[model samples]
Target: MSAPVVKGWCPGAHRPMMSGDGLVVRVRPRMARLTAEQVLGLCDAAQRHGNGRLDLTNRANLQLRGVSEQTHRQLLDDLANLDLLDPEPGLESRRNILVQPFYEHGDQTCRLTEILLDRLADLPELPAKFGFAIDTGSNRVLSENSADIRLETGMSGGLILRADGSQTGVCVSEERAIDAALGMARWFARHSSPELRRMRNLVRHTSLPGHWTGKPPGPLATRSEPGFTPKGPLVGAAFGQILALALDDLIRKSGARALRITPWRQILLEGGHSTPAPGFVTRPDDPLLTADACSGAPICPQAQAETQMIARQMAGRIGGSLHVSGCTKGCARQTAASVTLVGRNGRFDLVKRGRAGDEPAMRGLTPEDLLTLTDLT
Candidate 1:
């Protein structure tokens, strides 16, 4: 059978997407922190009903792969029992809020996140992928992330509600932040057609409020590193894929107080405690960190080539960032990479300094042929 195609919206726990795998069910943990029991429960559920592995998404969500249609109902029930499922099916798509993972309890980010969650119902119905970034950290941490709405710290250290792709933002008090955010959403909803789903798209055609102006926030302060940092212990998952059994074991051994997922192919273990786990990237310069890969071939029927295997082989040898995509869809990394290898008909097409969909510099190169090219240096 061919792989099922997914368009427009993202997959959720209640609404799954079909892939080469039987079914892909996503889990969005409220606040990005999962208890040890919840973590273990998720692993057990994935192993029992789906593929034994879990995919950590760029949105900090978890995806269970290879779930059979027959077992999907049971799996949803299991997830609900674990307090992992959204109460209302509609709420699942609307609760696309991402909180900074390093936030402390009762911090501004946490407070704002709660407010946003509570106000989700008041907002106009948005596209499933439309999201908010509650990035009120000490420094902007999610500037590079995907979000239509952003709650960021302004120059005055006061909160600002900024629409993505807009340099300006409206200053708002902590109390009114959610209201302003919702107002912006309503504005966008009123003006947007189906094609204009995101704030960036709406801004192209419609004018924003005059009040939405302030100094733009800076870029991400620093990229998170593996192992223990003051914020937490960062553990890397090669190609952003982790086996449920292995992760369960790691959690058992690490003794972390809590766990938070990151978009950067790593997991942050809160509390000062963490033990090095096998198959995890511990060092900063681990070559795998520079490579973005997707599950290809047998796992994804759309894939004509194996992606992770090729990425693993190219890790230490290749310099700079690389993306090994199963096809032109470029699911692994949305942005253009320094070098991209797009698979076609069991061979690779090289796209230099562009995304997978970009015109290829060369085509039909096997992994061995690709490695032998002197131009790679």
Candidate 2:
């Protein structure tokens, strides 16, 4: 099998990435919240045009995998009908904004996100992967997520435009937050070349403003399990994956007004309270919740070995978070895993307390052997 392809850019509904099974069409919902009707339509489209699999990305985007070329146009039309598609591809590509999920309607988070989306056309062309995180909630939940420019809560309970790598940021109010963020984007565009696309990369070459001493925002609230939040109940999808049928069933049964897609593999339902959903991880201690696994083997042309199945089987045996990657690319989890098993020509290479691309402690072990060895270790 050929090595897994890592496109520096992300795939969208208009521009999809080719995978082993078929095309992967990604949908970035407005504010990462989908209405109940929109959710049902998305599931229907996935069931009809794709492989009946919907993968939730770390960026809180939903992807319909295994989409056939014949059905691609129809799926796009369906998405458009659901008000999910962007008429212009350029605007769509540039509208990579992630918002905190717990915001109420007409709140600061929603207002700022709407402003950013409207002004996406005004910004200079950026790398497809470059994005903005609007984490201006009671606490910051997206610091751990990927975002070049952040509009987060300042230590003094105000707004700040903080670069990803820098501790200091320029303080701004709600009215001027977007302008400050856009200013940062323009600055990055002027200073950056193709090689330096992200804010972190630009920070290596240029220094950001240190005039404002507002510290980074607060910690993320623990919401990765099936439980009740102020907004509603959250349901966890194992390995950040949900079957189209199961999701459709859950939406129908839950009677939720909307579904808030979170980066942590959890989906918040807008309702009075939380309820346990079948075929979902409802507990915090579920091993699958901690394990990160990519779609491997026949599903991905780059994979030489199976991954998700092995990750599920090995989840209980491993002590901490485990990443069973299809290859050295480590697409599943960017962070270092407690135990990483990298796939190579149908065999596994183990990297203890390191990332998938890190130096391996052992090589060329079968899946069974790998599990037994990890058990002993």
Candidate 3:
């Protein structure tokens, strides 16, 4: 099979990306959330305008796949009415921000994100995937998530503007936080080229200023698990793929006031009651929660093997973290896993405690071989 191409840019509602299935239209929820009505409406739109399934991206965005050209315009109108679409493509492209799900309304995270949204237009040219994290919560919850520029809390209890690869950050107050982030963005714009598109890549050779490299960040918060949270039930979508009908049913049955998207393959149903949904992972220990796989085979042209079924079979029986990628691109997960199965020539190559593209210990293993063998490590 041909290797998957890594598109430098991500899909936006205004600028959709074409995939094997159809158009991949992404929706960036304002503050990583959607009202109950908005959630229902999006579900309806997904059913009508695209494939009946929606994908929850690692960047805390929602995507509708399998969209046709004829329905694309109507889908945009639906998204606009829901207040999910930005006015123009440039605005949508620039607004790549991730917020911790636990932030309350009008809190530091909220305020900072609002300011950042307003100032997005003022920032210099950036890579298509260039992003920011307003992780100004009690602890740095977004530490595992991807972002070029981060506004996180310092160990000394203040905001710090940290580049992606920096060990430390310069502390700034609430008022000046966005300005500091913008300055760093301009720095990145100047230093980065087409090939060196990400901040982490640039920082490997170029050093951050002394001012932005002294203060350490605060301890990271524990990752949210699939279970009932004070806010609501945190449910996991297997492979970040949710059937629109099941989601619609879930919202209605759980009586959730709203839906909060997370970078993890989980959703926070704000004020939702605990209920066992058919397709959702409700228990914290559910094996599907830990299994990361991308849409493979016909859905994605680059896949050499069908990933979802084999991943489902391997989830519980495996010893540690598992990633079953369709190809080397590893879209479902960025980090290495204890057992990674990379698809090659309609078979599998196993990488233990390494990424998908890493060298495999075993090659040319069929699905039967993986299921029958005992040890993954």
Candidate 4:
């Protein structure tokens, strides 16, 4: 059966509305991978066809917000030309798959990931947030906080696919390794309600399949540290536009085509290493990494200031992750970072929370004064 057509708020659509069932519209520009030319094209397209702004999602994906209905078709067509669209719409959001930067470089893990995408694309009910991680046996992969399903190399030339906190399947071949993951995803889709959008959610309520014995698998030699850094030095992009352009260029220049869009609004470009050109920022200590801002004010109709601009100004100055929202909607990151700046009128309010959704202390402050609030710093 063909996948279900997603209903509700289509992202990048011109309409300012909300939909419980959101649609993930895929775009492909020549630079999905990072190359200089591709990066420029992506930036130009985003500026012209989108809200003249771009957002960097925690998953490291570049989202062009405020896309009008007229441009939506063009965006999809363009992305398709770049081979960015998943064959099946059902798999669009569920394609939350990741691979270790090291293992992804011309290895079996990368090949297996493609197969997994193909398999999940055919499965209609996978949750919109269903995710997979294939470790390239590198230290710089995302933590378990980032993936619902993970594949790590095991001792004796086998692979182990873990679900939530337990090992569910083990295989000797990469093909079988990915197949084991798809089996679990399809099972979750069959048993879960549409409201349970993530694998963790499903795991919270349901027991494992009968085939799942809950037995611990054999010890694997290649275990990834929870938050191991990837092979290269960490780089941060001020916003999604910079990231999109940098990624496009990275893909073009370096044969290192595998890209991992992280949830931290950071892009992980694997393979060849290159420095950012003039007018672009790539340092970890850059202010952009320290701050996150939403599309605010004039652009969002729901914002108070151009949060991105404010954030860019305060990036490196702030010590922890400071999220700047145009309004309470908070489209920046899912989990609250160290500090949050919610904009209202020309002023801002400060909130402190350990995680995304925690109640914050809504005290007001000005941008200039915010620089002095040293608790987070």
Candidate 5:
């Protein structure tokens, strides 16, 4: 089989990347949230102009796939009408910020995010994938997510601006955090080359100022599960993929005033009740939560085999973290897993305790073979 191409750039609503099925248009909801009416409008557009699948991205964004070029204009129009589209493509692309899911309006996270959003135009020209994370909650939630700069609360309960790949950050007041972050961005822009596009990469090659290395961040956040939260009910979606119709039903049945996406493939139904909704994972221990898979076969041209179905079949049986990727690209899960199944020529190459691209211990395993395999753990 041919190798899968890795695209460094991410998709945006104005600049979507073409996929096997169609255009993959990404929607970066400000502060990682969407109101009920906005969500319903987006669902309508997804069903009418694109595939009915709404992808909850690891970056806490949403994507509508399978959009044809002919329908793309109409889809853009619909999104604009819903106030979802940013007219300036550059502004939309530059606003790649991730927020902790539980932020309230005018809170620290929201206020910092608003300041950053207002100043996006002031940011220096950098790589498309460069991003920021607002993790100022009592517990830092975006520690694992990708970001060039991070605004987080320190162990001493003071705000700090940290560069990714650094253990400590520079403490700053609420009013000056944005300026300090922008300073770090300027530093990155000056030091980074084509080979060093991300801040994490640049940080490793050069030393940060002595002042930016002493204030430790707050504790890591506890895992959020499917159940009740102060905001409302939390829910999960298998493979971070949700059907538009299922989401529509969930919103209507649960009466969710808003939806907040997370890096953990879960959603917070703000002001919503815990109601039984079909096609939404309401159990915290759902087997699918431990498994990861990407769109394979017909949906992804580079995929060698069908992925999601086999992933669903092997979830509970795998006994631990499993990553079933379409190809070596491992789009589903970049990190390590207990069992990594890499698709090749319509078969799976099994790699134990590694990533999808790692050397597989077994090759040419069929679906039936996987179903009957033992000793996965």
Candidate 6:
């Protein structure tokens, strides 16, 4: 494990740092139509050259861990050979575009992703965290609208970008549609403060001018096709090492390698053309997705029990998004989940929020007795 660097407001600071001589590798395996075999090779490289661990980021990007002071150049050379390295320098961080992997190519949503990435790469001041999302004509993709910029298809045949409940211009042609989105992002970047990390923050101090307002085609909606829902199951890894190994095996067996590393401390592998083995998990209701724990004990000085070990034991019995933390730092997930088990010494405190079928409550319950009182089973 490496020492964590304390950073200020920049998005790059939030990501693991590389030395001046170190390389930041990007892989585009050309499997846009599906997840492919390159994912296995990438995982193997992480184990050998960089850190033995790999981070699955919230943006659906992967990070190789622990590149020593040496081997930096060799890593870059290897990644370039694999066509995984992005040609654009310093622009890699700005290309925070999210696309629905479940959708087919040539759709408006897919087109928007490509356009946004290209436009953003040309702008130097675009915040590293600045992101764009294309919801592939589906309800599941709409939840990803938390992105800085979001594009959705309207009930009519047009598309619109929504910012803070207001609709922007509607585009008849896919080219003009993406151009308008890029204009919006460029405008926001010019007016926002350096301290404003996301569009939501920029919108707080600024309002959408009349020049930017236009008629939205209509309410954006997605129609689900059979088996179009993101089918891969999210699984927790004890640490990045375990994650790398499991990822390697999955990629090797399925030849479907595209992966999404969620900020929630879980990895999502698109099933591609092949279905996983019978025992393989791929549903939201799976026990693995139900529980999460931080690196604790000896690995982290402030930790209590090996949270992952305890959480795995209790996974089947618990339901909802359950998290076990060594301390209050909450390095696991961004938001407080449905259930949280915070550790103190060797004892545990269970907290519950929201009803089974309702939106989870913002407040969390903290009581020792609740652990035995509730019928989580």
Q: Which regions of candidate 3 deviate over 4 angstroms?
A: none
For every candidate in turn, the CA RMSD to the true structure comes to: 2.0, 1.8, 1.0, 6.7, 1.2, 6.4
State which candidate, 5 or 6, has the greater TM-score: 5
Candidate 1: residue pairs that collide: none
Worst 10 residues of 5 by lDDT: 1-10
> Which model is ahead, 1 or 3, in terms of lDDT?
3
- For candidate 6, the lDDT comes to 0.54
Question: Global lDDT for candidate 2?
Answer: 0.86
- Colliding pairs, model 6: 26-84, 27-84, 36-257, 51-65, 51-66, 56-261
Residue 161: error of model 3 in Å?
1.2
Candidate 6 matches the true fold with a TM-score of: 0.70
lDDT of each: 0.86, 0.86, 0.92, 0.55, 0.91, 0.54
- The model with the greatest TM-score is 3
Select the stronger candidate by lDDT from 1 and 4: 1
- Tens digits of per-residue lDDT for model 4, 238-317: 65445344455555564444554544555555554665443344554465655667656665555665677767766666
Residue 312 in model 5: lDDT: 93
- TM for candidate 1 is 0.95
Put down candidate 3 lDDT per residue, 38-99, tens digits, no spaces.
99999999999998889999999999999998999999999999998988789899999999
lDDT accuracy of residue 242 in candidate 5: 91
TM-score of each: 0.95, 0.95, 0.98, 0.71, 0.97, 0.70
* Number of backbone collisions per candidate: 0, 0, 0, 34, 0, 6
Worst 10 residues of 4 by lDDT: 13-22
Clashes of 2: 0
